[model samples]
Target: MTSVPHVPVVVVGGGQAGLSTSYWLKSRGIEHLVFERRTAAHVWETTRWDTFCLVTPNWQCRLPGHPYDGPDPDGFMKKDEIVAYVKGFVAKVAPPIREGVSVERAFRRGDGVFEVKTSEGDVTCDEIVVATGGYSDPIIPRMAERLPEMIVQMHSEQYRRPEALPEGAVLVVGSGQSGAQIAEDLHLAGRKVHLAVGPAPRCARFYRGRDVVTWLADMGYYEMTVDSHPLREGVRDNTNHYVTGRDGGRDIDLRRFAREGMELYGVLDDFRDGELRFRPNLAESLDFADRTYNGINAAIDKHIAQAGVEAPPPSVYEPVWRPDAERTALPLDGSGISAIVWCIGFTPNFRWLDAPVFNGAGRPAHRRGITECRGVSFIGLPWLNTWGSGRFGAVGDDAEHVVSTIAARLEGAAPAIQAAE
Candidate 1:
């Protein structure tokens, strides 16, 4: 009925990954259009919690060549600082991002280009980079909705602090980093905190005196190849720990949360009236839930041994590190917990992307975020490059690869496009 507008390239999302991809594309003189649903600052600002900070040290904050190796290299950046950093990055490297444009759909035209439908307008492009992020959609479980409305609930994204929650014993569901942190925060704020330990693998921010992430980086854990190693499977299985804000330096780790008086439970059995109920067999189930965690710790120990680093006594963290507790579940009726924090995590939203590039997992099928679907690509996904693809420090490598891939696809037309546009 109407004519669809056209652009040479369309980049969806304005987050770190999308902005990084756009920066690379611009470097090669490729003209592109980026569709951001909100203002540039709001994207990161909206995701921030009251006590949010980056887990990676400043030195590793480099976006490719732009290293965050300032004088305070070892320190972590706060959420606001991160937002400023991203803002500065975009201002200097990639200016004039199309803001407030929401992408509604994108389908392969089956020609050599794509048709991207957005809240602003439809634009056809030869290539599309879906950098919307893996955390675009929160994965709230089906059981959650059925819970009594009187219990009060909210997801991690919507939570600012404990002061905002109801004045009752808080039931922090999902034992990943966020749940643990929130539970700890609520407990410290003087509310009874009960953390639901799901199938999440637990890990301390630091094992000995060294940061686990730093140690992993040094061991080239991020450099593992998804092609040959089965580590992708390993990573996928144990990726829950990093989901929450609990790396020691950034915030109090989970063990400290538990030590500080948060009641830890195995799983939620049901909820009734104002009293939230949980499974009774906590200790045994906790052991079962911690197998993957212990496995990872063991793997790290093996790595340390191989590197000839002095291994700490195994007794310090026997079996699983958290101390034994006589009672597990804590009731949450009086602690104004009218809201629930669903720090549960996110799933890739590719529904708008009608391209046939997705794998069975509904994720875009790609060898390192470069998809086979003509003109369709992905970036900013977990472990896309090394172990840091989703992190700022590692995005540069994938960005470079994606830029190169797009360059080859464009052949020699890059210069002409830049000159014309």
Candidate 2:
């Protein structure tokens, strides 16, 4: 039997969130062991793509005392730029990260510690933070199982570029950010792409001349406390933050794709023969449902009109939405579609974490990322706080809090995080 290594804290991922946590722990004079599935540079390098860019603007990519004080503050950071930024973060604050240690299982040892069993060996820690993000697993709906064996299919995670796709039409599912962008990309690549949009609120790729993130910050949207406001609750409950990227920018938003030969349908109903079917009357249903969203925009327009706030002409950033009643279907070979790409968003992965702290949703039931369960905590969750908890600008706050909690617990006091815990 191999002996399990022991440590003060064990962070189970080496991504942006995990690195941030480790960085803060090191700064606070905390001893930690970071078990990463891959090497430091290779992890970020694998996630990189030609068109990959952060939706969060450069200025917002701040982690603790370190912020992205690059040349371009307003613009988004490309994949290489982000990788370089993270590399700089690691170098400046050298955290003890162990690469190539893929965790196989994690369960509480009952002595206020966690026993993390990895492929290489095992380790024990006073605390564990599962920083692996939601996108680790790609989920294909059950309907996909019935599709014809000849049909080509791939999820957004597998798609690197338009050139990788087989030459033919495409069907993209899940109208969220990823789905919308992939559908738009395939269509732009001269492949007939049909998008199956679920019931979701549409957002402009940008508002005015500035990025939508700027407007969201200015309007107190990001600042809204998750506990106090219903809209904030809805934003947190329904979906993750939606900051549009270059792939779905104002010039080539989802609505433009609909106008440019990319058919937009409702939810995917079923697949039979060589045909893919969907709900009905997708267009008319969307029009009716959009009336509600139009009301909100009209209110904004009315305010602008009343305030005499003259703005530049509108860009191609029109709204995109789907009505609940609309159920349209489409045939696969009928549209000449050769592949199906699922761009649906991600969910957190907690499979290795076998602790009893998980809530009904399978997320660690920590109070603001601080574990109520002994010897366990969560970090890097989306929108963990109002000021910032999940974003690059916000991750440092959560990391600091988790570190403090660990310190306080060691001191035999209640885990009192000075900030964001």
Q: Which parts of model 2 have CA positions greater than 4 angstroms off?
A: 1-3, 40-44, 231-234, 240-243, 247-252, 284-327, 416-421
lDDT of each: 0.68, 0.68
Cα lDDT of model 2 by residue, 169-288, tens digit: 777887665666566566767888877866555554455555656655755655565565566434455543223466434433455566677777877777876566777756653453
Candidate 1's TM-score reads: 0.85
Model 1 agreement with the true structure over 148-213: per-residue lDDT tens digits: 678777778777878877776667777666666666667767887767766655655566556667
Best by TM-score: 2
| Model 1 misplaced regions, further than 4 Å | 1-4, 242-260, 269-281, 288-315, 319-337, 412-421
Model 2 poorest ten-residue lDDT run: 315-324
